[model samples]
Target chain A: MLDKDIKKNESADNFVLRLFVAGASANSARAISNIRSICELYLKNRYELEIVDVYQQPLLAQQEQLIALPLLIKKNPLPERRMFGDMSDLKKVLKGLGINEVI
Target chain B: MDYSAKNKSKLNVLPKTPTGISGLDDITRGGLPQGRPTLICGGAGSGKTLMSLEFIINGATKYNEPGVFMAFEEKTEELILNVASLGFDLASLIKSKKVSLDYVYVDRNDMEETGQFDLDGVFIRLGYAIDQIGAKRVVLDTIENLFSDLTNESIVRAELRRLFQWLKDKGVTAIITGEKGDKLLTRRGLEEYVSDCVIFLDHRIVNQISTRLLRVVKYRGSTHGTNEYPFLIDSDGISVLPVTSLHMDDVATSERISTGITSLDSMLGGKGFFRGSSILISGTAGTGKTNIAATFASSICDRGEKCIYFSFEESANQIVRNMRSIGLDLQKHIDAGLLEICATRPTMFGLEMHLVDMHKKVTEIKPDAVIIDPITNLVTVGSVNDVKSMLIRLIDFLQRGQITVLFTALTINKSVAEQTYEAISSLVDAWLLLRDIEFNGERNRGVYLMKSRGMKHSNQIREFIITDNGLDLVDVYLGPDGVLTGSAREAQILKEHTGDVLKGYQKTRKDREILRKKKILEATILTLKAEFESVEEELNRTYTEELLTRNILEKNRKEITNIRGTSSENNTEENGPHIET
Candidate 1:
């Protein structure tokens, strides 16, 4: 069933991303702003993003096996990918997310 | 600063948290720095994980302090299963909320690094676990995994520094384990970040026998043992032997205890070994070293006190059966809980492990006496010096508890035996040497006190005999040639006894002959006296008769001459005739 959902999301070209961060930290804020702008400019309205604060949901951080802050996990992509850091390097972030060209 | 005030402040400036592992706290001098991180670095399979887990478990169980264990290499279940053999029920500790386990599975294959990142997630998770259990201790076992999981070395290093600072700020005593490097203490130099304390564990095989050693490399504010101490890992977990007591001021007692052989006791000041003293019984093979050790053990048990016998040469049943032949009923003492026989091959473990095992047993049983039968077998596992050092530690431990210990050592060669005893004899209070007295084409056992400190002991070597009744020490015969033993001594005694009887008989016969000669001499003197008296009587009668004849002749003549009252001349003539007759 999870595979079917991922396939359906992939057919519709919907981008699902989960970003784990510590609450209100400078790195978390920078990562949030950087990814928001990149997603708006590149995927437009075709992407869905969920921001989770590990401070508020520490068990979620353990479940995700998170070691670094501002970790991004792409959910709906056929091949899931994880990226660590504040998402400041746009080229590396875009490459990790499988985005080829600028919008 | 005033000196007194400075000393007062220094007394407790570094409050330590006690690690409940045996002997570790002793060497660490009350354990690791409190509320600070201690880095434990060692090579692979060197018991890094096991030692850290024991720290957490000991904290949670013994100190009543909750702890968190975060594993970077092993998962939580694997970590639990790994320590199960040590009798640590991690799952139960977790259920009771005394411990929390977190496995940070970081696989480099599944993640990519885009830019700058920090370890806030690890911090939050660790903080959450600590808060959940109010933990005062934490363990991040081999956080060096981060260096492998991440491509950025600078980030991992920086984050580790921050993590250590965070752990310190949170006020929890933590242990961070790392893999040893070729040149540095840790592969990633984790020791640089956790600077409050550093411990090094090493596992090395010497002479095909592997020994685990632990060393406290540095303690920031406290003095710790700097020597590399041998540690043991068994069902009870890791035990680091301090190897030597810092002080040699153990109180000596004047009380004495029996050595189970009455005549042997007579050799040793007519009492026995001093209480709480180490006694060494050394001899060649088949010289009844084990028999003497068993006798000591039985003597202890006979006093209704507990005794533990550690046999490296024989099994428990074999020792029991063998001892029974010499009238030592060890099984009854064992059944009565006064005696415990622990038999293990010397090759089964390193010398340190055997020492730790004996230490643990002594601690558990609190015995009054201990016996190590044939400690020479331990030479198979370690060098003579190694055995000596191990025995030094063992004796120190047993002496501190005021327990008398008897050690039996087998002498292989004369020179080596002397060398071995020369190394260990000084450490003991009394030394009993058993040797084979080879004389008259027979090998007889002889025992002599090489030295008994603070006592007047016999210098004579007694003939040692093991009979159906028990062990006995007979005074060896000093013969014309030399010391006599076995049948030669008996024969010499018999010869002297017979000679005494023959000498007495000859003296009596000579005395009787002299008495018979004296009686014959007395009879001859009496007969000679009788003959002499008879002859004198005959002479007197003849003289008297002659005088009477002269008188009769004179009377007749006088009568013829007128009644011959004649003249003075005639009377003169008659008197002259009588005198001539």
Candidate 2:
């Protein structure tokens, strides 16, 4: 399974991510910092991140059907994935974003 | 602040919001706790979604309060389409800003949780919708889906708790639905948070019949009905039946309504039945129970009042046609809008559904009288106790509405009939038992007034007859043999009439014979008297002759009376006279 994931990762495209959060909540700030650092360390220059505050853009939250704050969605991956919570666990975030191996 | 103080000064009771669903308000004593979240838990297909939807819709349309509905399982379009079948115009309400629908899609496979989080996104979305419509009521249908979507149970629980508190702070009366758990009220124990009010719905199938029930498990700071009330989901949405008001203080009226049979009315203390009273007519099959019920119904309509007939055994047209044979024109009343006939098979619904349907009909029609043709047919769908309970509630409801009702029960036999009568007889104000009196190789109908609560009623069984003209009661003939009915009664009457004629003829003959005898005897006496007179005259003549002879011999005894004496004297004088001659 690791060899297959390595082969798929070799041909994978740029990572497109969108993080939905409330305005300056402690959890949202932690999730934003954690995901940015993880992306910069793992897939630098190969990932694009967009952050949306649900309080400012409630229509976006409604359209995206956001339930939990600090929600992150990987839009570019062939199989899109969503993660809830403040991304405190690096290993779990990497696994959820399908980063099986660290560059 | 002044209003709050006034409310507090009155009874110190918690103010409640009215949920316009039928009978639900009565059960909750008013409605759900105002400005608090009420947890509604039920199993699949137990009408949780529909109930909450109705709450929101009723609040929006009836109370002039806008509402927000957040569905977790179904999307907004699906919700609108689904409730459209129940006669709810969700789209129009949404367009008019009276209702706002938000569908929250929760898929476990699409989401992953990395660390701690709160449900602020849901709060913002819900808050936005509520603010958009200024909604006073909110519904979260099956929020248990979040438990499945999110893996961390503790976080979800904490977030849900906060969300409930936030909703309370928003001052909106909220209903949160949850799926039934194995042993708990809800799968995720949502009741632990929304503690102000908890309602449980159940759908069960007993003996091949399905029934839905609603129970108010708990209502903090207020008293509510603790019984499991049966509810129904028809085209008009869910309606709960709060069976049996514990109070027996229904007002009684002295107004009497006719039974449409004069003799029958005469048997019932010269009146038929008390208004707002329940009457039971129990009889065997083909004993004309329906005929009696139809007669009463038509009589109600004849007074320019309304009547609703619930027929379980036959269709409306069939009842009308059959009643026409006995001269009851039910169709005319139906055409005049004074009568309505509802026909359905007994097996179509469970006993409680029938009851709820009946309550709905009574509320809708507001009829003066209601007739259930052959309530015994309900026994096929439920136990005797179930039917009895249903009927008790029905009678209570109708009586409370001040509507008279008539029930026809088919009694299979004597013992069973007595059992049924004993079960229902106590609940009814009047009971008329129709029996088939089999005698002289014929079967005749006899109606007995088993009981009439508040008035004088005849105890004697009347000979019930149904003819082309209408129904009537004949006084049961008491003859030498026994109580006679049918051909036996007619035969006895005929014999008595013949005997009277014969006795009259004999009396006249004897009178004429006595007159003839008296005339003959008087004639004989007259003839005899005449004879006597003649004889007396002859004697006198003879006496006179004798006297004359004697007188010739002796100086004449001239008179007859003195002849004897004179003759004796004249004997000598007559000799002397003769010698002188």
TM-score evaluated only on chain B, model 2: 0.88
Candidate 1 reaches a DockQ of: 0.70
For every candidate in turn, the CA RMSD to the true structure comes to: 5.8, 7.2
Given candidate 2, what's the lDDT at residue B316?
94
* lDDT values for all models: 0.89, 0.89
Model 2 regions more than 4 Å off: A1-12, A77-79, A95-103, B1-12, B415-417, B515-581
Q: Write the per-residue lDDT of candidate 1 for residues B266-339, one digit (tens) a residue.
A: 99889999999999999988999999989989999999999999998889999999989998899999999999
Best prediction by TM-score: 1
DockQ of each: 0.70, 0.64
TM-score of each: 0.88, 0.87
Q: Which candidate is the best by lDDT?
A: 2
> Could you give the CAPRI-style class of model 1?
medium
Candidate 1 Cα deviation (angstroms), residue B502: 2.8
